[model samples]
Target chain A: MIRLVPRSDTPALLQVATPVMAVLATMIAGGILFAIMGYDPVAAIKTIFWDPLFGLAASYSRPQLLVKAAPLILIASGLAVGFRAGIWNIGAEGQYIIGAITGAAVALAAYPAPEMWIFPAMVIAGAAGGWAWGMIPALLRNWFGASEILVSLMLVYVAQRIAAWMAFGPMRNPEGFGMPGSRNLQQYPAASNPELIAGTGAHWGVVAAAAAVLATWFLMSRHIRGFHIRAAGTAPRAARFAGVRPETLVAFCLGLSGALAGMAGLFEVAGPAGQITDKVGVGYGFTAIIVAFLGRLHPVGILLAGLLLALTYIGGELAQLTMNLPAATVQVFQGMLLFFLLGFDLLTRYRIARRVTA
Target chain B: MIDPIALFLLLLSASTPILFAALGELVVERAGVLNLGVEGMMIMGALSGFATAHYSGNAFLGFAAAALAGALVALPFAILTQFLMSNQVASGLALTLFGLGLAALFGKPVEGVKAPTMAAGPLGLNWIVWLGLAMVPAIWWFLNRSRAGLILRGVGENHDAAHALGYDVRQVRLAAIAFGGAMAGVGGAFISIATVLQWTEGMTAGAGWIALAIVVFSNWTAPGVLAGAWLFGGVTVLQLRLQAAGVRVPVQLLSMAPYLATIIVLVAISARQKFSRRAGGAAPGSLGQDFHALR
Candidate 1:
């Protein structure tokens, strides 16, 4: 028999190492999974992990990593802040969709006019759209005491429907003979979020992502608001005694995450994705939850975790192209990463001991 | 005018999945374990049930396989939360993500495959629907009359008190979680084998989450779960019919009806509870809390 003894103080070092260990464990498990599916395990793992970064097609795949990581990093950074305050804003996907729709609406409304201020105005609209969408749950929770988790998640389905409606009815590109998507923003010069440097894939979204990282790090470490968030999560009664209003905290966290997710969506539409479509929500909001936890809810950790997840996306595609692996193989690998992370986290708080036999 | 019997039958079938999952979750919550991975377990069951039924040419066996598959998937969550004492919400979410991915991987080969045909039971309804309906009273009796049910509730209400009274809290919770998993699996199987009759990626969609909401909507009662599931089912069928009717509104907008209705119901329930000064009625005292045995 074995027993788990509670730790007086959680080992900080172990908490940090668990994510790294989780990644390695995921790779091994992914290898075994691939082998069971009748593929060469080592080759499959190498294709997913190594080939995207330094393999023969690295030049093509490396740029895609930044393109993918920007939105993930930006969205994850925003999500981590709320997560720290015990706010589960899992409806980032909805905010992202609304942002893309609102942003695209601005661009299309000003079609054929290359105005200097149009793009900036669109960005603001995108942020506001996401913010308002997120506020529904926040306001509901504050006023009616509803569960934010369920309300926010329900909004995702609603948002998906809204997006589909926009694509089919309002946002359809007139020039494309009634196809179901807005005008490709890439072709529009003033509104396009093009790569600043050739072949680097560094667009306006990448800049925003980097800025978000620095800003989040500073806010978490240096701001009094951050203190309130931590205090609320760790000790709610203490936070209340210290004058942290629960309603305000809930609104701010949910609204801030929504705005960031919206910006990410706007950037994605104007840059990589190129247009607002029916299927715009590709699970970034959902995946960012995993990224937030995988990063240990730290800004810098989120940045790195975003890159690691982005690597899997690139590698998963590469494996699909090189081998006959299913496209969802990456999703399974990501899911495994979270499981291992959660499982390994047990080590930080508890010590396993053998039961003495009498 | 719609045929009342046909509409009721559609509502029954539509609500059956949510009913099964919500009732299962009702028990889990009563036992003070919140398993958020119902979506994952449901999807896993859908694929496994469909695959087994397709291979064996037997729908009942397929459902059995689904139950086993769901319970098997939930074992890791039980171990992690019960023994290891990890964060319940995070572990449950991870379980969902993992279950979805694993189902996708395992289901890749069986995509679009037709399930074995199911035979009708009493009242011309599928056997699963009857099972779902019967479970309502059965669960009501289990929670209200049975000794084990009383012990489970005792454990959920206060693990410390239960422990002091010599009941195995961990064992009771683990059993509850496994039962929830099995029910969720059957719920998922009902979708693929009974309703859609074909496996697709992410087919359970957000039914699991809705079921979670239904537990709260029902105030954690077996009867309330039944009511919530039917209301949700009615909204779903209405939306589909509206979309089919093409009544000027966009199909997308019509599709949002069920989700929007769910939010509205939740808001109304919460608002009533707040205004009436009843702070958290019928909620399991230890729901969503981690339980660890200290020596």
Candidate 2:
């Protein structure tokens, strides 16, 4: 029997190679899973991974990559900042929903009026809405000593309900004869998040996501506040010794993440989603957590990881249409990625070894 | 009219899942390990139990399958966190995500298919509900009276001391984790078979998370878990009743009451714990920390 021996030091090569290895392992496992399901594993894999970028149907799917990746990257970027500081704010989904509703509230209030400031006002409302929602957990944790994870996650169900209420009641479009959705923002150019470029799917959300990447990279690497965040996560006692306030860091991280998630929600509503609906939040907030982990919680890495996940989303949809796979197959695939990443993450801290018992 | 009998029965049924999961987790925590993957394990159990029962038309077999499935899913978590020394928080999160995904995948085909309805016995309650009620006392006895339970608690309170006394800390922990997984599995099975009676994607709907919080809110006690579960169940049943009554509130908002109640309960309990420094006030000494033996 092989026994694992702990190593004293981790190598640089192993740090980079583990994620790559995990991906390969997942691919093999996925192929086997497909075979078991009586599907052509190789062709199915191609449809999911290869066809989205290089295959004949790449034209339509290519633009979708950006559309999907934009929100994921935006949300993940914010989540990563909080995660790095060990402030577990798991309710970005709730924030996202509230942001969409708040943002759309602004747009709907200004319907039929083509004003330049309407869209900008909607974006601000979305960000502020998310920030306010996030502050609830942060304040509770600070004041009453509540677990942010439980509080934040619980809020998600509440937010979903609120969104449902808005879509079915207050925000329901008057002219649409009682549908459970608001007026499409696409029809109102003033509040719409139209593409900056005509056909490439490059919209303001993508721009904001890119800007967030750069801004977070700078904040984490250069700013003193960032140092405090990192120090707090690595060692709370030491950070306290260095005059870092734990409660302040918790609020900041939670607030920043909430705002970023809200921005992603706003962009989505104003762009791809195009209206406030019962399904406005989707699962982007939850999926963004995976993206944050997959990116290893680094800003630059988050950008690349976001694109890769976006590719999977496009590919999953394409695979569903072309290969007759179920819609949830993508969720499973993404879940597999997280499992493999986590499983392989062990290599970073501990090395496996063979041992002999005397 | 308040129908106290119906209310009591609903509360009992709701508390079953929480009791099973909390008791299991209580065992695991007593072994000095905090497994946050309870949600994932429960979801796996839900899907597996539903699938097995749907296919075989045996609710008993379905519950057994769920327990086995939950234990199987938890094995890797034990290996990675215990042997490989991976971060417990990260591993737990991954487990939840993976479990949710895998359940959705496997449950896709099983969607809309009804499981074999659990027959109401002479008592007018399903067998699983009775079993859940029975488990409360059994769990209390196991944790408070059993030798294995004492050893488990000893390890949780102080692993190094337990190790010095020649107890296999790792082995004890593994057993506790497996036991926890099995109990959580039964809870999930209860949801699918006794409650929902149908397989739907993501049907557990944060019940696992609520159970996790209940364990904390209960201050890691069996009776407390039962009370918390009943409280949540009351909220859930009341919401359903309100919806049935066609109350002015939206159904969506009504459905959210339980989750909100959970958060409120968690916050209240946490505050009480902070203020009171009694024996049961503090969390377990070695919670969420991985043990590394230096020989």
Best by DockQ: 1
Distance from true location, Cα of B210 in model 2, Å: 0.5
What TM-score does each prediction get for chain A alone?
Answer: 0.97, 0.96
> Candidate 1 lDDT, tens digit per residue, B39-154?
99999999999999999999999999999999899998998889778788888888898899899888978887788878899778999999999999999999999999999999
Predicted structure with the largest TM-score when compared to the true one: 1
Residues A1-358 of candidate 1 have per-residue lDDT tens digits of 9888888877778878989999999989898899899999999999988999999999999998899999999889988999898898988989998888888889999988988998898888888888888899999999998989889989999988888888888888898898998899999998888988888788988999999999988888899998889889989899999999999999999999999999989999988998988898988988898899899999988999999999999999999999989988988898889888888888878888898777
- Among these predictions, the greatest lDDT belongs to 1
Q: How large an RMSD does model 2 have?
A: 2.0
Whole-model lDDT, candidate 2? 0.85
Per-residue lDDT, model 2, residue A338, is: 75
Q: Give candidate 1 misplaced runs (Cα > 4 Å).
A: A353-358
Worst window of 10 by summed lDDT in candidate 2 chain B: B274-283
**What range of 10 consecutive residues in model 1 chain A has the weakest lDDT sum?**
A6-15
Per-prediction interface RMSD in Å:
1.1, 1.7
